[model samples]
Target chain A: MQIQSISLSDSLILTLLTLVIYQSAAWAQQKSKFIWLNPLLVTIIVLIPFLLLSKIPYANYRLSTHFLNALLEPAIVALGYPLYLQLQHIKRNWKLLVAILVLGVILVVTLSFSLTMLLIHQKEIAIALSLKSVTTPVGIIITEQLQGDSSITPFAIIIAGFAGGLLGPSWLRFLKIRSDIAAGLSIGAASHVIGSMIISKDNPYQGAYSSVALIICAVLTAFIMPLLMPILSVFFA
Target chain B: MKDIIYTVLTITLCLVLGKLINFSVSGLPASLYGMIIYCLLLQLGLVKPIKVHKTNQWAIKHMGVCFIPAAVGVINHFELIQNHGLTIIGIIFFTTFALLTFVAVLAEKYLANKSESSPSTSNC
Candidate 1:
C-alpha cells in the first residue's frame, strides 16, 4: 500500500500537524459545551479538506500519520488500566453484563442488516452496516471478511460513534435509564470509544463499563458476524 | 526517566505477548488481546500499576487523537457516501438508537431489580 515513500521531514511535519489540530479541537471541546466539536471528527474534517486542497494523496497523509496509528494498539492496551480499576464492579455483574452484550450485539447487527438490505438492497453496504457498532479496526476487518465494502466501514463507524456520542446520554436520561452501568454499556456497545470517551467525562464508572462493553462487543462481533452474515443473507433473500 | 522506561517495557511486553497469541488465534486483534493480558497481569500482580500509571493515563485520555488518521481515510470513499449517504445515515441512526434503547432499558431494569433485591451491591 506504500505506493510512494514520504520523506522523513514530511512525515514528521504531518505528524506534528495532526497533533496540533487534534489538541486544538480537544481544547475547543473542553472549553465549549458543544458536542459537534469532537476532536476526532474535527481532526478528520480539517485534515481531509486540507489534504485534498493541497493535492496530497490520502496515501501520503496516512503514511505521514502512521505514528499516530501505531499508537492505537498501545492506546487500546491503556484501556486495560481503567478496566482493571473497575474489575470488582465488572466481576459482580459479569453474568448480567455478558447477557446484555450478547443480546445487544445480536439486536444491533440484525437491525442494521435488515434495515440496509430492505432499503438499499446492497449486500456490501448491508454487511458494513451490520458491523458498524464495533471499534473501527475490528469493524473494517470483519467487513472485509464478510466481503463488504471495507471503505465504507470506517465512515459508518464514525457516524455511529458521532450519533452515540451526541445523543446517547440525553436519550438515556429522557428514558430515565439512570444506571451508570446501563448507560455505559449501551453507549459503549453501540458507539465504541467515542461514546465511551464522552461519557467518561461525566462519570468514570460509566466510562469503565463502556470500555468493557467496547472490548466485548468487538470480540463478539468479530466471531459472530462471519457466522451470522450468511444466515442473515438467506433470511433477507 | 526510570518510570517512563518501566512503563514502556511493561506495555511492550503485553503487546508482544498479545501479538504472539494473535499469531495463533486468527480473528481478534492483538491489541484486544494485549488489553486483556494487561488486565490479567494487573489482576495477578505481575505488573505493578504504579509503573505504568502515568503512560496509561495519558494514552487513555488522548486516545481520540490516535483515531484521526483512520477516520480521515473515509475521504477516499466520497462516492460511496454520495451514492447512499442518506440511506446509510438513516440506517445507522435508526439502528444505533434502537440498540441504545434496547440495551439501556433492559440493563436498567435488571440493575434496578438487582439493587432492590440486594441493596449492598448498588454502588451507583
Candidate 2:
C-alpha cells in the first residue's frame, strides 16, 4: 500500500523556505532597476533562480501552495461583510451602479476583441484575450464559450489583474482624478478582487461600491462575451 | 475585542450562507449573493452590524499582506510574457484606458446626482 506522510518537519521546512525566499525577494525589490516590476515580480525573479537549482519540481511546488490559493475563494466570501456595510451606498446609487455595470460590460467586450483583432490576427487568441479584463472564473467561462484555449485564460487574467492593480492608482493621479468611487470601481472592474482590496485600504467607501461593481461587471462580461465573440470572429477572420 | 470577534463570526456565517446560495443558484456570483445575504442579515438584526471603527482600521491597515500569494503566481508567467511582449503591452494599454474612462465618467455622474440630492459632504 502506498501512503503519504504529513509531518510537522515537512511543514516547518516549507515554512522556512517560503519565508527565506519571500524575504530575499523583498530585499531584491528594493534594488531592482525597473520601477514597474514590483515585489510580486521580485518574488518571480527569485523563484526562477531557485526553481532551476532545487530538486522540487513545479508540480510539487504547486501541491504545497494549492491550499493557500484555495483560501482565496473563502477570502472572497469574507469580503461580503465589508460589502454589506456599503449596501446603503449601493441603494442610494442604484441607477448609477446599473449604468456603470451595463456600460462597463459593453466596453470591456467591445474593446478587448476590437483591440485584439486590430493588433493581432489570431481569432482564438483574440477570443481568449476577450476575457483578459475579467476575474479568473468568469474569464475562463468566456474563454470556453468562444472556443478559445483554456490554458491561457489564467495567465491572461492574472496579468490583467496585475496590470490593472499596478497602474490603476497612478492613472487616477496622472489624470488629476480625485473621486474615491471612480478609483475603486476602476481598480475592481479592471483588476478583480485584488484591486478592490487595494482600493479598500485607501478608501473603504468606494471599495464597497467597486467590490459590488467588480462582481457585477464580471457576471455581465461573462454573459455578454459568448454573444460578442462570434461578431468579432468575422472581423478577425 | 468583542466587536472584532463579532465581526469575524458574522463574516464566517456570511461565507457559509453565501457558498450555499451560490451552489443553489449557479448563475449569480457567489460573493455577490453572500454580500446581499449578509446585508439582509444586518438589516434584519440576525447579524450584528459593525461600526467601522478600530477593527476595520486594522483590516485596512494590513490588507497588503493578502496580496502576497497572488503576486507569487504572477512570477511564474514572466517568460510567456517575454515572448508576447507587444501583445501584452497593447492589451494592458487599451484595457487600462478603457476601464479608467468608464469608471471616471460613471462615478462623476453618480457623485453629481448624490450631491444634488443631498447636502454635499467632502468626506469621501
Candidate 3:
C-alpha cells in the first residue's frame, strides 16, 4: 500500500486502458437489454479488480487518467447543449420546474443528512452523505465547504448514480409514473447525469428534462446545503 | 474540421470563464459556471448550436467514461467502506428511492393536470 509515482509512459498506458475498457463497456451496455449493464458501473466493476490484482494504486490510476478527469469539466459544460435544446420547454414551465427542483433538493438533503446522522452518528459522513444526489463536482465542492470527507462524497455520488441508473426507470414504472417529464426530472435530480444519460437514450425529451433537473438541482443544492446544514446539524446535535 | 475546432475552443473558453467566475464568487464548481455561461451564450446567439453539436453529442454520449477515474479512486477508501459500507449503501438507496418517489409522484400530478388543462403544451 505504498503510493508509487507512475511514469509518463505508464500513465499513457493506463489512460488508454481506461478508454478501451470504457468503450467496451459502452458497447456492451448498448448491445445488452439489461438495465443494470450501465457503462460506468461496468467500467468500475472491471477496473477496480483489475487495479487491485495488477497492484496499481488508485492514486496512480487517477494520475494516469488525469486528462480524462479534466475532460469532465468540459463534458459538464457540454451539457448545455441539451439544456439549450430544451429551452422552450424549460421556459414554458420554469416556475413549476424550479419549485419542484427546489423542494426536491431540500428533501434529498434533509433525508440523507438525517438518515446518516441517525444511523451512523458521524457528522462528517453525514455531511458528505447529504450531497450525494447532486453531480460529483458539486457534491465534492459542498463536501469540502462543510468540512466533510471529500473522498466519501464521490463514492456516495457514484453509488447514488448507479442506483438511479439501474433501477430508476423500472421503479418509476412500478410506481406508475408515466410522464416523461416526471420520470426525467426525478431521475436527473435524484441520480444526476448517469441516470439521466441512461434515460435519455430511451427518449431524448426525457433526457432534456433530466439535464434541466440535473442543472437546477445542482445549483439549488449548492445554495441550499450551506444554509440548511447548520439548521439540520442542530437536530443531530 | 473548422466546426470541431470552434467547438473545442468555445467549450474551453467557457470553462476558463467559469473558473474565473468561481475564483471571484466561490461556492459552485467552475464546471457548473461554465455550463451556465455556455447555456447563456447559446441562448443569446453568441454561440450557435451547429458549431458545438458534434462535440456535445459525443461528450454527452460518452460522459460516463470521464467519471471512471474518479469512481476508481473509490478503491482508495476501502477502510472507510469496510467500516460503514452497508449503512452508507442503505442510506443512499433508501433516500434516493424516497426522493425519486417524492419528486416523481408530485411532478406527475402537477404535470398531468397541467397537460390536461392546456393540451397544447402537452406535446413536449
Candidate 4:
C-alpha cells in the first residue's frame, strides 16, 4: 500500500488558492454591495464548484489553509482595539448602553434559540442557531461547546448577518425608527461585524453603537450559553 | 513597519496570556481572555492606541475575507443541510429580523424619551 504525502509548501499553495478565491469572489460582489450576496456566501458558492471540478478534498483544502485558520483566533483577540476606541461613547451613555445591550443580548439569543428549536426540532442545531448573531470566532466556539455541527455555524452566522444587514435598514425606515444608537445597536445584535460595516458607512454613530453591541452580545452569549446548556439538558431530559 | 511589529507582538502577548488563562480555567475561550487582556493593556497605558492603529484597521478591513474558508466546512456537511436546511435558514432569518425590529424599536423609544427629558450634555 502506498501513502500519499503532502508538504508544508503544498499546503501553503492550497491556502493561497483558497485566499485568492475568497478575495476574487468578494471583489466581484463589491460593486453590488447586496447583503445576501456577501463575500462569505460568494466564497462558499465559488469555492465548492472549484473544489469539485479540481477533484480536491475539502479536508485537504482546510488543512492547506491551516495558517488562516490559526489567524482567526488572533484576529478575535484584536477586537479589543475597536472596543477600546469606542469605550468613550459607551462610558458617556453608560446607563443607556448597558440597558440596551443587556436587553438586546437577551432578546436576540432567546428569540433565535426558541425560534430555531421550535422550527428545526434538532437539539444540537437549535443550540448552534442560537449563536448565529455573534461574530464567526465566537459563534464557532459556542457551537462546538454546545455539541452542534461546527461546520454549519459560519453559514448560519452569514445568514443572520445578511438578514440584519440587508433588511434591517429598510425595516427601520418602515417603522420610523430614527435613532442612530437604537438602529446601530439592533443591527449589531442581529448581525455583528458585517452589519456594523454597513451601518458605519452611512453613520458613524450607528457604527460605533453597533460595534459595542457586538462586544456585549458576544460576551453575554459566551457566558449565557455555557450556563444555559446544563439547565437546558435537565429540562430536555 | 513599527506599527505592524507592535501590533503583532501585542496580539501575540495577549493571545498567549489568554491561552494561559484558558489552560487554568478550562471554561472560558482563549480569544476572549486575550481580548480582555488586550483591553486592559490599552487602558493601563502600557500600549499606545496609536502604535497599533494601522494594523488594527488593516486587520479589521480584511476580517470578513479571513472567515470564508471556515465557512467552507459546510461543504462537508451537505447531508446535514439537506435534512434541516429550510427550517434552519428560515428560523435564522425570521428570528433575526424579529430581533432587529425589537431592539431598534425599543432602543429608539428609550433614547427618544431620554433626549426629551434632558438637554443633551455630550454629543455621544
TM-score of each: 0.84, 0.64, 0.85, 0.89
Candidate 2 — which pairs collide? none
Please report how far candidate 3 places residue A102 from its true position, in Å: 0.4
Question: Best DockQ goes to which candidate?
Answer: 3
Off by over 4 Å in 1: A117-124, A135-154, A169-181, A196-212, A226-237, B116-124
CAPRI class assigned to model 3:
acceptable
lDDT of candidate 2 over B7-124, digit per residue (tens): 6666567667767886986644455455466657767767655542345445533332233334344434556567666785678667756876777667766753463122111111
Give the per-residue lDDT of model 3 (tens digit) for A1-237.
Answer: 666887999989999988998898779877885657766677888889999999888777888888988787788788676667756556667788789888988998999999899888899889888889987766765676679876688778878987987799999999999888888789889898778767777887777677778767877887889889889999988
Off by over 4 Å in 2: A1-12, A19-39, A113-188, A191-237, B1-12, B28-36, B51-79, B106-113, B116-124
Residue B4, candidate 3: alpha-carbon lDDT: 87
Best by lDDT: 3
True contacts kept of 3: 0.62
Worst 10 residues of 3 chain B by lDDT: B115-124
Order by lDDT, highest first: 3, 1, 4, 2
Residue pairs clashing, model 4: none
For model 1, residues B1-124, the per-residue Cα lDDT tens digits are 7878887778788888889998997555777678788889998999888887777777666777776776786777788778878989999999999989988998898864563211111111
Q: Residue-wise lDDT of candidate 4 within A52-125, one digit each (tens)?
A: 79877777777777788778788878888776766645565668766766766666666666666666666777
TM-score-superior candidate, 2 or 4? 4
CAPRI grade of model 1: acceptable
**Selected candidate, larger DockQ, 1 vs 3:** 3
lDDT of 2 by residue, A1-237 (tens): 222444556545654565566556646654763333444445555655665586444445544554544444444444444544444456766676667767877787778778876776556666766776665545554465457744456556666666766677787788766766667667777777556655665677656656666666765675577666677667666
- Among incorrect, acceptable, medium and high, the docking class of model 2 is acceptable
